[model samples]
Target: MATFNVRPDIDAAVAKLSSTVGTKREIQHLPEVLWEGETVEMLATGVYGKGNGLLVMTNQRLVFYFHGVMSQKVEDFPYRSVSSVQWSGGMLMGTLTVFASGNKAEIKQVPKDQGKALADLLRQRISEATSAPTQAAPAAAPAGDIASRLATLDQLRAAGAITDEEYRDRRTKILDSL
Candidate 1:
């Protein structure tokens, strides 16, 4: 991969998107987010115009963004979901190919250094994702939630916000719901 001067056009596009894009920090703590535990590792600017795109590598996924002044599209491939990742072409431009969930996505005409860096970062993340214990969330979530609820109920009862009978009823309901 050859490192080229980042053109003013690429920098300008990146600057515009940075403020508008939703980042890992903004979504990681969301309870309903599926690709949980993701954090941005790197981001790179791509070609401009309707074909303008962003390459974002996260701890849990590789994300591609296609944007124009009028519209935008974002695609995510979780490291676990990816079957293979490959790249080709020369120093001036290249393509990134990712096979995931039985489908393939190719990001074309990206600068060589950006594409190679993205590929290297993705390979590292994929290896980590594969070795890590899979989502243990389901096993621990209910126990943690129930314990917290029990504590809150105890606090409410002590504060006289709820009668003992009411506290007991709510606590039992919370336990049963779990």
Candidate 2:
């Protein structure tokens, strides 16, 4: 399973939330996945509120809802600048955009300070999404042989250990030397 180092403040917030809500909290951090030898980092987190509400935050968006009722929507949150977030009953009811030009945070809401619970809920969601998978580990490679070498080569290629050209060259050499 992937792991992430949670910010100290976020970790503290999660702890406070678990105690306040009287439920066990789960946290997760996901590493970047590789596709076609390219690495992509996409981070998201969630928190569950007092009711059935949820708060979700990603690199690009922040969404809050309860049982399908839309309470808040914020977009383009400048994923690079987010330091930490806190929740209270009324602090998160509207959209928030941080402006880099002036180092200011702009918040819009129907009633200000109404989104604390929602923020907490989103933190929880992120925690759950990043939790470790429960599946069993794959079996180890067998003893060295044509089949084993081929399998190892395939695994290495899949893990981006060698370029396609290098893999093809090594595979040809292995087969010829056999």
In model 1, which residue pairs have backbone atoms overlapping below 3 Å?
A: none
Worst 10 residues of 2 by lDDT: 26-35
Q: Each candidate's root-mean-square deviation in Å?
A: 14.7, 16.8
What's the count of clashing pairs in each model shown? 0, 19
**Which candidate has the top score in lDDT?**
1
State every prediction's TM-score relative to the real structure. Answer: 0.51, 0.23
After superposition, the stretches of candidate 1 with alpha carbons farther than 4 Å from their true spots are 1-38, 47-50, 133-178
Per-residue lDDT of candidate 1, residues 42-106 (tens digit):
66555433455667666667777664446656677878667578989676888888876556787
**Candidate 2, superposed: residue stretches over 4 Å from native:** 1-61, 64-84, 88-113, 134-178
lDDT of 2 by residue, 106-138 (tens): 343422332444445445544454354765423
lDDT score of residue 46 within candidate 1: 53
